[model samples]
Target: MPELPEVEVVRAGLAPAVTGAVIVGVEVFEPRSLRRHDSASGHFADLLQSRGVLAAVRRGKFLWLPLDSGRALVVHLGMSGQVLLRSPGSDTDRHLRIRLQIEHPEHGELWVNFVDQRIFGSMAVDSMQPTRDGLTAGYSGLAGGATGADGLAGSGLGWSGLIPSQVAHIARDPLDPGFSAPLFLAALARKKTGIKRALLDQTLISGIGNIYADEALFEARVHYEQPADSLSPAKGRALLGAVRSILNRALAEGGTSFDAQYVNVNGQSGYFSHRLNTYGRQGLPCPRCGTLLVRQQFMNRSSHLCPRCQRLR
Candidate 1:
């Protein structure tokens, strides 16, 4: 599963070309790639053809392109999915499932290819809803978004402050400027579950997975099994700060790419995997304390940590 940093890289990559680009054609080589698409709403191809992309926005792991029609094309990159941008005559990407032929005023024609080896990823055309807070729906770098014909930074539609209806349930990610730390900390102080489980709760805090959760816990020196509400306010703040730091570092490094399945639009692998302090490093020596790290079966998955450094107490 692609986490925030990985998805953000894709979103940022798409923003430059897709903003204001008109969808000239939509090709679906694999219908399963649109499993999440609602047939009752409208035909996928028909709904998108000739529609202009407003902006590429994301909240948590969910990515969406707001169309001028006020509907959004929601994209979920389940495991083994990659969105690639390429020229018309370029070498075809393997496992290509869907391709959007878009024409931009200045950039001309380009292809946005949705490639997924496992077929778990999906694309859909969905309705939109106004955000409760009336804040911008998601992050588009719109504050510093792609420049347009008028030399403006963002689309008028981008400021609509509407999010895809299909993605309404996701909470804002830590990296989102609108994510409220005081509110999140207050909520964390009320959680009855384990800290790791709480972090994995998208409804609670979005964009965290087993990988980053482990890394953040290690950084905060907090045990995965520790209760969320058990942390004092200072400790909670410290943990949140650790998450931001780790995510920023991962973003700078282009996110963790364990395999070729995870790559940016240009198909380059992120090297953050090399900087991992914990996660998938079981039995390796913990960098901070020289203790042997361990992996424990957790919620049908696995958790990596330093038994000595990340003490449950």
Candidate 2:
């Protein structure tokens, strides 16, 4: 599954390619990929035709496309969905689920294709009000834009800003500009869950998945089995800082690519996999303590860690 950084990279890649381009047509090859409107076949075509993309934004893992109309197109890439911008006469991949052709006067014609082999990706067009209400009502402020920072501060939530709805459900987002040592420590202090499971909770901290969580835990020299609430404030702060550093470095390197399926918009795999400390490096010598890195399954996900380095509390 593409996590926050990967999705952000995808959004950044598509911004220049599709921004301001007027949608000339919409084609859906896999009907199930369109989650909104049972009759998405005709509805998508009608809504997209002649509508210009006003802005492209990402809230959590979902890409938001605000069109000329009041409606917004929400896209979830799911497991292996990718948005590719192709030039005129370029061949569309057979795995394409949705394609939107944009008529750009100067750039010639551009095709934005959503390709997903797993069929887990989703596309939906709906009113912004319902979307906002649904996000706020159902998931608190953790889905996208949900709560006002001032109100949150007044309510003793201890933070501010346009809190993405996912934040309410997860902990802290290392990539978010508002991330702070104190905030991260507070979230960590409240959980008795395993460190790895705590890291995966979107309400605890946003953007981390199985891979990065293991990598971050390894980098911090913390065992995944450690109880989140048992970590000292200093250790929590250290772990928070490590998470930021690791993720920032990964983003700088275009995120870790596991296979050909996880390439970026340019069809390039992330270079960070080479710098991995423990992830997918079972039996390899640990960089810190020279112990063999170990892999174990917890909650149905593999966790890589160094036993000597990551001592249990």
Which candidate number would show the highest lDDT if scored against the true structure? Answer: 1
Q: Mind giving the per-residue lDDT tens digits that candidate 1 earns over 222-249?
A: 9999999899899899999999998889
lDDT of each: 0.88, 0.71
Over the full model, what C-alpha lDDT does candidate 1 score relative to the true structure?
0.88
Candidate 1 TM-score, true structure as reference: 0.94
Regions of candidate 2 where Cα sits further than 4 Å from its true position: 36-42, 129-172, 179-181
Candidate 1 root-mean-square deviation in Å: 2.8
**Residue 313 error, candidate 2, Å:** 0.8
Clashes of each: 0, 19
lDDT of 2 by residue, 1-313 (tens): 3777777777777767666679988898999998644453348778778987755666455666666675656677888888878875688786889988898666768888888989888777755432222222122123343345323334322121222232234343566544555766786798888888888777667777777888889888899999999998888888888887887888788877888777777777887889888989999999988899999988987889999999997
* Local error of candidate 2 at residue 251 (angstroms): 1.0
List the candidate 1 regions with Cα displacement exceeding 4 Å.
Answer: 144-159
